[model samples]
Target: MDDINAWVWWLVGAAGLGIPLVVTAMPEFGMLSVGAVAAAVAAGLGGGVVLQVLVFVIVSVALIAVVRPVAARHRTQLPELATGIEALKGKQAIVLERVDGSGAGRVKLGGEIWSARSLDGTQAYEVGQEVDVVDIDGATAIVM
Candidate 1:
């Protein structure tokens, strides 16, 4: 309505922008919401409509240009965390029983007993010997 202040309209616009940001999980909407807030500040300071619009556009464009690439770069980078079987590979295990290529044996790996076999068919690991895990085959660990 004509009676409503321009700053109040800008606040409403910001809230409207916030809805899509929440629902879609898009950062651009959030940047636009911040721009709306900047426009609201301009309105509160008695700036003309063109000045308020200019403030909104400049703030929105700046945020999008700067934040989007940084966010994309972070998203594309891989985390340095390894879990489950992946964490077991290349780890040291103590042979609980004689480990050989011909039969299954037990090894204490990461504080747990795991079925193990030798990586090389002719090689064998004696009890209390330390071995390096090479790979995981189902429930068994291949060690050397």
Candidate 2:
């Protein structure tokens, strides 16, 4: 252990930390990997083991404290645009068939025909009536 250069060990530690970071896709490990790289830089600059460890600790703590919150915020952020069936909700559709709880009906939504059911089982829509899509239930649209 004493034969190997300290900087080489630090770089190796960085690589070791980075491997798990990639495998697990965890930001914390990435932060630690970056800290290991900083430690390696300290060792390369002739800083002793204690100084290298200090550098690693400081860099890792700083990244966890600062970057982690921002990353979490981005992870939980709402998408800028909604795609797929989500885009169908709240849209206006024209009924193509009589809609009721008694039977399945059809509607023209976003230029596509979709199975539709009345939001209230008691209510119904005749052909050519306009309805608002409340939500999507499987391949069916709940409309009112």
- Model 2 segments more than 4 A misplaced: none
lDDT of each: 0.96, 0.93
Cα lDDT tens digits, model 1, 1-144, are 889999999999999999999999999999999999999999999999999999999999999999999999999998689899999999999999999996589999999999999999899999999999999999899999
Give the TM-scores of the predictions, in the order they appear: 0.75, 0.91
On a 0 to 100 scale, what is the lDDT of residue 98 in model 1?
Answer: 94
- Report the lDDT tens digits of candidate 2 across residue range 1-144: 989989999889999999998999998998999999999999999999899999999999999999999999999999989899898889999999999875489999999999999989999999999999999999899999
TM-score computed on alpha carbons, candidate 2 = 0.91
**Alpha-carbon runs more than 4 Å astray in model 1:** 81-86, 98-104, 115-126, 134-144
- List all candidate RMSDs to the true structure: 3.2, 1.5
Model 1 RMSD in angstroms: 3.2
